[model samples]
Target: MNSGIGPMVKSQSSIPLYAIILILCLIAIIGGYFLSKKYPLNTNELKAIFEKEDGESNDITEPSGDIGNSYAAIDSSGVESGEHGHYATPLSQVNKHNIDEVFHVAGELVDYDTADQVCKQYGARLASYDELLHAYQHGAEWCNYGWSQNQTAYYPTQKKTWERLQYGKTELEKTMCGVPGLNGGRFKKNMKFNVNCFGKRPDKPDTDFVHPKLPKKPTKEQSKEELKHFDDLVVIPYNRKRWSRKDYEPHPV
Candidate 1:
């Protein structure tokens, strides 16, 4: 009987096929992993992760306040502090045109009429370059060397008083006073304050409720260029508002 158990000669090398298969499987797994990392399989899920992260960032969803859309300094209001102080409003936000009412506005081209209304609402006119200066200036008017403050420190806030103004003029005076004079209208609140404390409160400090600092007014020169414009239908920071001699020379428009 021929023994089938005798040493059998291997017909083919199983090592090559097995080794090649193992290598191919290892390569396939590694390649698959790398590809998955680069191009994920669950595309929607990956997209969702990115969307969630981006959506949560304030920079992405927050409105472009008076500040424009771009990296810039943040104001005390936690919005963008614009360049040249030309405020930026989000296209989606409601804006009252402030440019129109600024005794004389400068910096950016704005919807003057809308800005005018906005200013009126706040009892603030479009800040002429001079007026804007009040928000930041320290020391004497026209004293460029003097310390100036930022918006955060500029106004504590508009006063809660029935009359909220800065020039110390009564709200009635502001309403009644024609250009170049105090408001002298028939409104009871206006007429009453005009008689009682117009001169005493020549400077409006929001009735001392909100931000309480009365910024020194603009210099004379700044007043001429910035305020004179108001007399001509153009709004400007008035010169009478000037508080010091250093600001005697009118600033260039």
Candidate 2:
């Protein structure tokens, strides 16, 4: 019993494996938090970089016919397709003063009243005949028939293609150019069609202007004189050698 070397006791200074691992994990977490605070992440910039690397684009090509109906769908920002054919930027971002711009508002066919209301909802009005024609000259083309001012429906075409000709010749001679009036016959008020909206939305109601007094109806003789004057100023000059013999004779509206 003199050589007593009883049971050995465990060392109290040594740390447990589990405890050491937990401390290291805490340190890593703290370091990561500080690093994130110093360098914030930009999702947009990252997306742009990834898109660039992938050769992806946000620009959409111009679609044709009914297949292009998606062009009329409005985004959350309240904009459809952009100027001409590209569908990249929201129209709200474009210059409001550019009168040449034309926007197709309705993807589905709608009556004249609905079309007008739809355009108004967009803070625009039905495009005028002259405005549509000017837009066509400036490279605006849409296959769908659209409601225009004066209760007319017109669809712009770059050329007189057979598909376009199926709508019919605007003139008797069939040689007229530019935006031809739809030959499907006189447009009915309830007839459904697309809407072409023009102009920027007014910031406020126009209260400064007063309505002009209505003009008195002219007598039959006065009407005839006015008709002759109109023929001289507009009809004759416009028709010249272009219109047919039937066009020279006045037809009842």
Candidate 3:
């Protein structure tokens, strides 16, 4: 009897080619994984791999109309505070033509109608009560009270005293006017308070800005002449006798 080694060799040779190929592939994959640990792919390498596989361009562009750096710092009620003072936000958020521009006319008391006119002169309107409250909430400084568009009077106070009755009770915070409520009620329309103004941006950029010629600033000589003229003006109800040095004398304490 022949001890048949040839029969066993023939049986192994009969195994499928695909089986051999699969076993070789598994070995290659394990070796590749270990090799990858030694030589890890970087960002550029990974990106190149993705580009090659996806067949896509690498020139990525940021989408247009994004807010980007053009942030409108105004609050919900359309108000912004700046180095100059608080100002009403422009109607258009896209173009902040005057967002930080100090456009308000304060420091002088004026009636409601006069305040309106003052704002009109500056191409603005008196800011409404809602608008003022919005500014106040956005950390606007309030001083000496002012008139709102609705012909009411108010001075901005700390957040949520009586105006924003947060806890079903009115809490007083340290502000000028003592007790708290947003509405100073309706003042006599003629009664004066400094005005806060609101302006709207033009629908488009003011390309025709040159049409309405802006006044030139006074030269040094012109300013001196004007100053001299103003100083030369005499103010009198002919009260020379009444306005004597004696009038300014302090009384005995």
Candidate 4:
């Protein structure tokens, strides 16, 4: 009973609680490294995670080079480029032959402003005097007096029909639609008349210069009202049959 050791004391853990926690964290980190090596995140996923951590927007759009080049080409084309949904023609590319091509839109005795709007609706503009003359020289024949630029009206005809002759009998009519001139006569801006439209026709045609559809014809009642302005003897047929296939109705310029 008198031994030097009194009783065996229980042994305590040599590692502290903090050191044990550190060892567990190292094991978890090593396992995660292996898992990441087996299944790595894609670029988009990584970017999303980084964006979320940085509190940045995830919406990122790359610039388009083709779209930029297309705009540049349009700028260099020397055309009236469309803006805000309004289209126009490329006048710089127009040639002499294009000047000789014209179309007509019979008005219900509309004034210059109305006539201009009608032409624009059909994707065209008022023809110039020289353009009307060139068109006349190229066998463009219309029996209706149409409003042109410079507050003038003109009608081109190859034959001296009774319809034209009736108006030619008067002194003023002779001066308006007579020989030795381009068949153009000045008029008041408020005077009602038809419309002579000139379309854009480039020397080298392309899809950029597409022709617009023709406007709808007036109804029978509308035509009757229009007929009241002109005598029956001088009424010209306002139908598609009267227009030639050669006439141009291009997009607005």
TM-scores, one per candidate: 0.18, 0.35, 0.35, 0.34
Query: Candidate 2 regions off by >4 Å?
Result: 1-100, 160-185, 201-253
For candidate 4, write residues 122-170 as lDDT tens digits. 4578888887776655445444578888788987654332233333334
lDDT of each: 0.31, 0.53, 0.49, 0.55
The clash numbers for all candidates, in the given order, read: 40, 0, 0, 0
lDDT of 2 at 224: 71
Report how far residue 41 has shifted in candidate 1, in Å: 12
Local distance difference test, candidate 1: 0.31
Residue 77 lDDT, candidate 4, scale 0-100: 21
Off by over 4 Å in 1: 1-11, 14-19, 30-45, 48-59, 67-152, 155-253
Which structure among the candidates has the greatest lDDT?
A: 4
Looking at model 1, residue 171 earns an lDDT score of 58
Error of 3 at 21 (Å): 16
Model 1, TM vs. native? 0.18
Per-prediction CA RMSD (Å): 21.7, 24.6, 23.4, 23.2
Residue pairs in collision within model 3:
none
Cα displacement (Å) at residue 15, model 2: 99
Q: What is the lDDT of residue 116 in candidate 3?
A: 81
Sort by lDDT, best first.
4, 2, 3, 1
